[model samples]
Each structure stands twice: as C-alpha cells, then as structure tokens.
Target: MSPSRIMSRAIVLGFLFFLSAPLLSQSLTDEAATIDQLETRLKAADKEAVTAAMTVWVDRVRSKEAELVALVEKRSSVEGDEKSRLEEQIDALRTERDALADKAMVIVKAAKAQGVDGADANEAFLSGLSTHLDLKDPNALLTFALNWIKSPQGGIKWGLNILAFFAIIIGFKILSRIAGKVVAKTMKASRMQVSDLLRDFFINTVRKTVYFIGIMMALGQIGIDIGPLLAGIGVMGFVVGFALQGTLSNFASGIMILLYRPYDIGDVVSAAGATGKVTAMSLVSTTLTTPDNQIVVIPNSSIWGGVITNITGNDTRRVDLVFGIGYDDDIGLALRVLEDIVTKHPKVLESPAPVVQLHELADSSVNFVVRPWSKTSDYWTVYWDITKEVKERFDKEGLSIPYPQQDIHLHGLPTDAA
Candidate 1:
C-alpha cells in the first residue's frame, strides 16, 4: 500500500531469492553426483558394490512413498493454504519416486546384462546366443559362424542346404532366360497386336516375377518361413511406397496410358510439355525421340495428368500456313495462288478441299490463312512443301509480303526573325 513499505518488502524478497538460488543449484549438483555414484556402483562387477546400490535404490523409493503417505494424511486434516501446499509436495515426491524407479530398473537391467545374458529359465532355449556382441572375445563371431555351418553331430546338412539354395537360384536363372526367349519367339510368330516395346516390357516383367518367386522358394528350402517373410515384405513395401510416392503415381499413370492407348510407339505426340515421337514406354516413364534425334524421358504421371496431343492419332491433319500480303496487292489473286498451291500438292487431301481466305487485317498487310488437309503420314511433308511453293508462286506473281517497317517523317524548323 504505502511506497516505503512496498520498497522494503521488495528488498526482502530479492534477498531471499538470492539466498535460495545457490541452495537450489547445490541441491541439483548433489543429486546428480549421487545418481552418478549409484550408476557406477550398479555397473561395477563387484558383488558387494552392486548389492549395496540395489539396497539403496529400494530404500530411496520406500522412503519417498512414506513421506508422500504422511503428506496425504496431513492434507486430509488441514484446510486452505496448508493443505494445498502439502498436496503439491506429495505430488512432487511421487513424481520423484517414479523417476527414481525408472532409473533403478535401467540399472537392474544393466546388472543382469553384465552378469548373464538370457538368464531367465524361460529363455534357456536361446541360451546366450541372443546376445548382441562379446567385447571380451573377438573370436566369438568366427566360432558362431562355424557352429552354424557345422552342427554338433558333424552332419553336413547345413552344407547341403547352402548348396541347394545356390542350385535353386541357378536353375531359376536358366529357366527365366529360356522363358524370355520362348516369349519373344512366340510373340514374333503370332503377330501380336501390342507394340514391340510393350511386348518386351511385359515379357521381362513376367520373367523377373518368376525369378522373385523362385528366390522365395529357395529361402523356404533352407528352413526359412516364407509366410513371415512375405508379411515383412508387405510392411517394407508400404514404407517404400510412401517414400517413392511420385514413382508409384507414375506407375499408376503408366497403367492408365497402356489401357487407354492415347499414343502408340512411333506416333508423334505433344504431351508433358514436350513434343516428340513415342519411342519406348514403361510402367513408370515414357521414352521419346525428338525430330532432331535427341532422347527425352518423361514421367507417365506428367503425361497422364495433362492434355495429350496425339499429332498422329488422327487419319489426317491440317497443314495451316499464314501469309501477310501488302494492302496494295490483289487479295483475290493471292487467294487463287494459294488454291493452286493446295491443289497441286499430291499429299493434300481432296475431301477437305483446302480452305484459303483473308483471315486477318493488319496495319500494313492483309493476312491470308491457308489450311490444307493431308494424311497424317504426309503432314510434315505437305506443310514444308506448301510453305515453299506458296513463297515461290507469290514472288512469280509480284505479290508483296509485308514486314514490320517504320516510315520516317522529317519536319524542318522555322528560322527566328531578328
């Protein structure tokens, strides 16, 4: 309330805090030192030290629990601040005891590990073989490996099992090779409707699948449980699928492409933001060859997720050409010349009857749009041929092709009168 009294109270509180800080720090330091000593004693090979550490650990928990019980009894009697304070102390003591118990359990496990591994009677079948490493004897590894290979009875069953495993693998290898050859020959003889790339991809997939199955069988021959192995593989596959989410999506998209047949091999297509001919395809990606012979690989996810422009999908394609003629040039005459060019080209389709008209008006020229339909195979040929023919015919007829130009306007300044 009063300024002087408040100042005095603040000074007293500050002095108390200063005094308590070092005591708290020292208390923590002492606790840490005690824990370290206890851990050291528990790890020591000496029987007396270890036994004494265990006794102390048990006593510490019992003492804390007794203190908590007394505080709890006091809490039932007292009211208000005293009871709240006693309850808080009880909770703190309980937490401390729980933490101490956890630490003691860790120490006990360490003690057991130091004395004897797999010491419980129920684990007699495992013996000490379940142990991780033996730092005392480095030769234990060689001994264990030898024991696995040669049993106590000196029978060569383990040796024969190893041989059988390799034999099964080699047999599968030979079978897979023979099966692949047979599939190739059969596909060629039967004139399969699928593309060569898809055929090959399918055959190889089957062969590899067979090989994987054979390997699993080989493991079973050596007394390994195929059931648990398959379960473990399923779990591993889930994790790997998550890790390779994009790749799996590509795989799914590839399946959709194979089923839909949007663009086959040797078909020119613009897909996944690239224009190229489909050369090879797989379950994850598509291989393309550009006109310049450069190879491009695109993920099937990108192709399937976007618009696929199959340039060669249709039976015929339109070769669109535009010519900008000067305004002074004869527009009708230009259209006649374009019609002649379209008619003369052998590749142009007659049914479509090539359209030629004034398409756009510009500042300096009238743009003529010429569209000539041609077979898909002759699309590029007709485009190039029509473009070249139109240029030559326009020049012969004295038609002006206007380009971007700026006319200069010169103005003279008047002289000033004196």
Candidate 2:
C-alpha cells in the first residue's frame, strides 16, 4: 500500500509541476510582450515631441529671417536720399547681421558636432539670447546694439545714427559760435546800440531755429519722424509771439534806434521825461546817467518816438543876458559900458560879432539884450563874468536899475457934500 500510494503521489506531483511550468512560461511571455509594446510607444512619443520642437524652432528661424529681409529692403530703399550716409548705415547693419548669423551657425554646428542634442542646443541658444539682449544695464544695451549691428537688419547702422546725432549737436554749437562772433564784430565797428541789439537777437533766434532743424535731422537719421516735432515748434512759436507783442515792438524800436544815430553814448539828451547822458542801450531799454548822478532807464520806444533834445549836439553855443536899467538912465552911456564888458571878456568870440541892442521897454525898465557868442566850453565862464562886470559898472556910474511900480489913485467921495 505504501509503494503504490507513494508512486501515485509522485505522478500527481509531476503532472501538476508540468502544467504550472507552461502557464508560468506563457505569463512570462505576456509580460515581456507588454514591456516591449510600452517601450515602442515611448520611443514613438519621444520622436514626435522632437519633431514638434524642431518644427517650432524652424518656424522661429523663418520668422526672424522674414524680419531681417524686411529690414534689408528698408535699408536699400533709403539709399537714394542722403545716399552716402544711408549706404554707410546699410553696409554696417548688413555686416553686423552676417556676423551674428555666422557666429550662431558656428555655435549650432559645433554643438551638434560635439553630440549636443537638438533640444539642448536650442535651449542654450534661447537662454543665451535672453541673458544678452534686452537687459536693463547699459552694458546690456551696448551688447544688444552690437548684436543688432552685426545683423542683416542694420543694427550697426542704427548705433552709428546715434553717434551722428551728437555730431550734429556739435556742428550746431560751432555754427552758433561763428554766428555770434560775426554779429559781435559787426556791432563793435558801428558804435551803435540799436543795431547791435537787433543783430544779436536775430542771430540768437536763428541759431535756436537752426539747432532745432539739426535736431530733427539727427532724429530722422535714427529712424524717427520729425514732422510732428516741427509742427509743434511752429505752433509754440506763434503762441509765444502773441504773448510777447510788446517785446517785439521794443525790439523793432531798438533796430530803428541802431540804424538811425539820433543819439550816441555820452550824449546829453532830454527824452522820455528824463534828462541825462546816454550810457547803454539794449533791445528793451536805454540806460542813462543824469547830471545828478542818477542812473535812469528809458524804454526804446520813447527814445525812438519821443523828442530827443541833444544839448551837446553843437560845438559852440550862444550866451545871452538881459540887462535892464531905469528909463532916465542915459542910453549912450549904457551902450558904452556894455561894449567895454564884451571886449574885456576872453570867451567872447570876435568872429560872430557880439551885438547889444535896446531890445524892449517895459512899464518900469528899459531892457538891453546883450548877445555874446562863445565856445561851448566857455559858456558858463563868459556868462558869469559879463553879469558881474555889468553890475559893477552900473554901480560905479550911479546908474539906476528900475523896479516894477504900480500907480493907484484914491478917489474922494463924490462932491455929495458940496
């Protein structure tokens, strides 16, 4: 019983083991098949993702190329006007673009040659660009500018345009200096205030206007439109002119004063309610120093329009004195005394011939008008000497100088009493 039982158990165990081995082997094959299917699917997904990424990169490169081409067209179109300048700019930009492209191509090829994966190379390029371009620092701006200059878009040309702007500013400054010197020299030789002031004003205004044009030209070089800027300036100038009408009037008057030499420096003039020697004159006002040593400023309009009495215009002047005496005094004796006084005075001019006439007879006195000719320098001295000598002679001769007398009669109460 033990042998048969043991043999039956052995047969059952062998049958069970044989059946489980085929099942286990089949299960192992199924698991291997599933693993192979998953691996194949993963490989296909990787390939698709790579293709999509590469397509995106290629599209980006195409877009960039289109932009560069448009820039090139613009550069070419500008060649006709300011041809030399525009050509220089275009060439510089084209050189910059080529260099960048060549460098980028080299980097890509070298990376690829070194077995850098496509994704890695693209990522590196994008990261490098982000760090280098559009940074907030000046160095970043310069680097970005350099990159553009090397590009086909004429980035270098744009950079040079900025430099040209500074050069234009310098040129304008030089022009201003020259204009100023020219105006100054012209004024200095004229010995006039009005003309000098007007010339200066005109030159300054023109300088500012020309400088504005220079600015516009520079801006245009940098790809900016100057039309609006010019229009704005014109409108602003109109507004300013309207607001400063009085100022313009004075300026015009100043010009007239300069052109017409009515009064010069150090001329004594009575004008604009002021009597003084003209000192300095500008576009707006005339400066004067009065006899009392006071500084007075008068408007240009007053000088140009009002009466300007120049006291010192002539080199010689006349001094007249009225000598009056009593009607009873001897006229012949008076005339003789006056003649002596005139002959003795040193400042009396013999050429003009001094005349003493019995000019007027008043109610109380006979007036003798004594006319004496003298140089302006001797006017005061001769006048004083004649006056003093006349008094002395009249006193010595016992001749009387009369005073005004009013005669009045008192009427008695009518002969009513009679």
Candidate 3:
C-alpha cells in the first residue's frame, strides 16, 4: 500500500473510534457507582464480588489512555472549522479521561486499605498507572486504616478469584474428559471407520473447546467484561493465523487426508514425490520409512495436493513380468513353462488364476507377458521368485532367449570407397 493510503486508513480507524467514544464515556457514572457497591460488598468477605468489581473498573481505566490517544489522532486529521470544533471535544474528553484515571487509582487504594493485597504496583489498573500521595503522617495512615477496617467495602477477593478460577478449570476438565470418552466409545462401536489420527483430533479439539468456553464463563462470573477480552482474542487470533498460514495449509490438508483415508499407517504409498511405507503422521506432516531404512518427512499439503498411489491398499496385487524368446522358439512351449511356474508359486493366488500369453511379436524375438495375482504382502516375493524360475527353466528346457544384434551387409559401397 502507498503511504497516503496507509495514512488514510489510520485516519479512518481513528475517526471510527472517536465517533464511538461518547457512548463509551456515557457509562462512566454508572460504572463508578457499580465499583463503590462492589467494594462495599467485598469488605464483608464477599471476595469474588470484589475481584469482579475491580476488574471491571480497572479495565475501563486501562482503556482510557487508548481512547484519549485515538481522539487526539482524530482531532489532528480535520482542518479549519472542523479541526477547531474537534479540538474543543478532544480537550473536554482529555479532562474527563484524566479524572477517570485518577479515580481508578483511588479505587485501588481503597481496595488495598481493605486488605486486598493484590492491587499494589500496576496490579490495579489505575493505581499502578497514576501517582498517589504518600501517607507519611501517622495520623492520616491510622485514620485511613480505621475507615477501611470498619467499612463494609474492603479487600480479600483474591482468594475468591482463585477458587472461582479452579472451579471453572476442574469442572470443564471433567466434562471434557467425559465428552471425549463418549465420542471414542461411539466411534469404536459404530460402523463408520475413522482412522485413529482423525478420531484423536476430534476428541482433543472438543475438549479444548470446552475448556475455552469454561474459562470465559468463569471470567464473566467474576464480574470481568468477557466481551472486550473476547474481541481482543479474536484480533490476536487473526494475526497469529496470518503469520502461520503455511502451517494452516498443512493442517487443512491433513484433515482432508484423514477424512478421505487416502493412505494409512503401515501402507506402502507413493505420495509427496516420495515412495515408502507410511510410518507416522500428524496434522503438519507425514513420516515414511523407505526400503533402505531412510526416514522421509513430507508436508501434508504436498501429499494431499498430488497424486497418492496406495500400493498395499488392496488385499491382493498383480505382478507383471515380461520375457522374450527367439522368433523360432515354440510359443506354446514357452507359454506352458510360464504357466507352470506361476501355478506352483506358493504366494500366487489361484482364484484370479495365472495368465501367460504371447503379448507382442518383435523383429528378433517374441514377447510373452506373465501376469499373476498374489496376496499384496507377498506380491514382490512371487514376482522375483517366478522371474528367476523362468530364466533357469528356459535354460534347462533349451528355449532360446533373444538379444539385439545386426548382420553386416557392406559389399560394393566399401569397395567403391577403397
């Protein structure tokens, strides 16, 4: 994007925020009143309510500076009459914003006086950000302490927040476990055949989803504004997703592969430009062990986007072997020898039967195609053993195996050159 366009976008964002600022500001008085009530409730050992109240008040205070900055940016974008008008609005809001920040510190101090030890430093939104006067006078400290001790509004909500946090976690944990087990058990008993990888993915995703919802609910129960937090989380997720686009692609491909069952562990597959037996798989990549015992890892996207040949997917496989014999050799005898060899092979299946045919006639030799069906596991064994048998049997039976050769026919041309 060009500089002007980027600047324009920033201006528009600022404008939108300023347009909404008034409505947000309108709730200030109500929020302050709510904080006071929650504080009063806290001193009576109503720990959870106090934490909830403080979180609300503090978050609003933290957000004030952000709103002020946005308003100033917007005010700078206008010109002449509009700029002058915005300047007034920005100034008024700045004053209000400062008062709110100071108010936040006061709330923190009151909470601290009540034995709420957690708000020291920046722990309490306003108190940490804004400066408070030191209570150097003994009499002043004693007076504040007495008022706080006697006041119904005081600290001690930390313990309640902890209890609420754990309750949410433990409850969600149990529910997530039960839901996962039920899904697993159902899948196991059902006719639908889902791979272990896919099954586990579903289970884990469900459990995590449950835990996330549980946490959000718990936060809401403690008086925190879950809405704004959720919005922030959504933005963070977008940024993370953009940064991890490659990983996301692999993840999507992995899900597709699992659902389609293009290949499975222990299956010999030719995928991702590599041929090997599938040894392991995850949402990101698949691992293979080659014949030479070399390990290869291929991204799931690479595998899913290309052709996948599952060599051992079926219960049986066909082994094709071609042999050549001299043109003068008896075709029937050569075929009979091949058929005999295939039938006696232990690995070859009889149901599909063995096939031997004079497939093609070449200039110097006749080609015979020997096709045999065998158990997938024993396909290579049958192919190698039968091919070796044919070579030896042809030698023993006196059947000639032809090779390419040429006859010299140079005569008169050679004499003329000489």
Q: Which structure among the candidates has the greatest lDDT?
A: 3
Error of 1 at 196 (Å): 4.1
* Candidate 3 segments exceeding 4 Å error: 1-153, 156-162, 414-418
lDDT of 2 by residue, 371-392 (tens): 8889876888999999999999
Candidate 3 lDDT tens digits, 1-418: 8999999999999998776554333333245545555345344433333444455667776677676566666755666677556555544554455556555654555556656657675344453442121244344345445533443332235446667878987999899898889888988988988899899999898888888899898887676889899999999999999999999999999999999998899999999788999999998999999999999999999999999999999999999999999978888899889889989887888888878888998777899999999999998898889878999999999999989866778666434555
Q: Which residue window of length 10 is worst by lDDT in model 2?
A: 128-137
Arranged by lDDT, best first: 3, 1, 2
61-180: candidate 1 lDDT, tens digit per residue: 557657766676676677767755665565456557655554455444544555643323212222221222233433534443454345421236657777899999999988888888
List the global CA lDDT of all models. Answer: 0.73, 0.68, 0.75
Best-fitting candidate, measured by TM-score? 3
Stretches of candidate 1 exceeding 4 Å from the true structure: 1-223, 405-418
**How big is the positional error of residue 24 in model 2, measured in Å on the Cα after superposition?**
85
Report the error of model 2 at residue 302, Å.
Answer: 2.4
Model 1, residue 182: distance off in Å is: 12
